[model samples]
Target: LPAEKMAYLRSLQQKNKRVGMAGDGVNDAPALSQADVSFAMSTGTDVAIETADVTLLHGDISKISYCLSAAKITMNVIRQNLFWAFFYNIIAIPLAAGVFYPIWHISLNPMIAGIAMSLSSVTVVTNSLRLRMLIK
Candidate 1:
């Protein structure tokens, strides 16, 4: 069994950039340990549990899809946060530093800055919460 498993892993490694194995039995222990990421059922054998990197808390395999969706939403929120942070800093910093003062003496008020910062945080949190809607 180990020999066949190793052969399949080798073949998979050759054809895929990344491969993961999920199993819930003692017989699957070695293969689970050998894969890039192993997902073990909460009710799996001790050996399977010990060999896996991720253990499903409720033993529901469907949670894997939910997890992936949440991850995608989290990543998107992070990207949006970064974009907004960079955009605000690039524009606001220069303006607040008086870069435009020579022409119009314009600058962001401290109260406005505080409001904008709070709004940005709210936006990120709201975006992250959208993941709940994605779950089936």
Candidate 2:
């Protein structure tokens, strides 16, 4: 297929949709460069490989699904960790600073606060580790 035709097709698709191009030839480089996500085979021309967003090291096209799935899972794990971290800080900081002492006479002991902070960090790490199980 002509490179110009490929470029024309990409232009039409890109106006309202994301385009993913997979190519292995130098002639495919331009379209690959323009694609939202481009995949190049490891055995392809150097220009195609360099122009693409991702290289399939073993030239197995099926791995693209795995890559996309893993990316989504990783993003979710990051959001979960951030939420836990922020939630811990929001509740923990004010108590440690004695903000509730006047209202309810509640104060966090410094040693206990330290332990709680450490535990919060551990929780985030453990939550991240859960991804290993999910991804496989």
Candidate 3:
């Protein structure tokens, strides 16, 4: 039974799956090392803290759920930031290159486009800062 847990973790990783393991760190060191994400309790052995990607400061297992939620939110923010960046490039680049002048009789000033592009980056940063509100 002692080895069953690590075997299961290893099997999941070998299958190219995302594996998360929570442990005291000493006995589970090998499994923790193999996991895609590992959580160690603050009260756990020193080896666990060193090996873990995250340490549960409260040493409560339930905190793992909070961490998971934060991770998901962080990933979603990243996706949104990337989408905004790509979208900005797609439209701004064409206008800046004067591609719209022949079709719409509108000539975009490069200076204005540059300002708009910079605002896109600022908006993304402001959006990402929303993550701080989640901490509590």
Which segments of model 2 are wrong by more than 4 Å? 1-16
Give the candidates in order of TM-score, highest first.
Answer: 3, 2, 1
Q: Which regions in candidate 1 have their CA more than 4 angstroms from the true location? A: 2-7, 14-16, 26-30, 57-63, 100-105
Per-candidate TM-score against the hidden true structure: 0.68, 0.79, 0.85
Highest lDDT against the true fold, candidate: 2
Give per-residue CA lDDT, model 3, range 8-120, as digits (tens).
98888888899998988578877788789999999999998898899999689999989998999999999999999999999889888989889997767988988998899
Backbone collisions counted per model: 0, 0, 0
CA displacement after TM-score superposition, residue 9 of candidate 3 (Å): 0.8
Name the top TM-score candidate.
3
Q: Cα deviation of 121 in candidate 3 (Å)?
A: 1.5
TM-score of 1: 0.68
Q: Against the unseen true structure, what C-alpha lDDT does each candidate score?
A: 0.78, 0.89, 0.87
What are the per-residue Cα lDDT tens digits for candidate 1 across 1-136? Answer: 8667756876788887466777888888888877877789999998999998888887889776666666677777779878887887788778767788888888878788778778877877777677667544
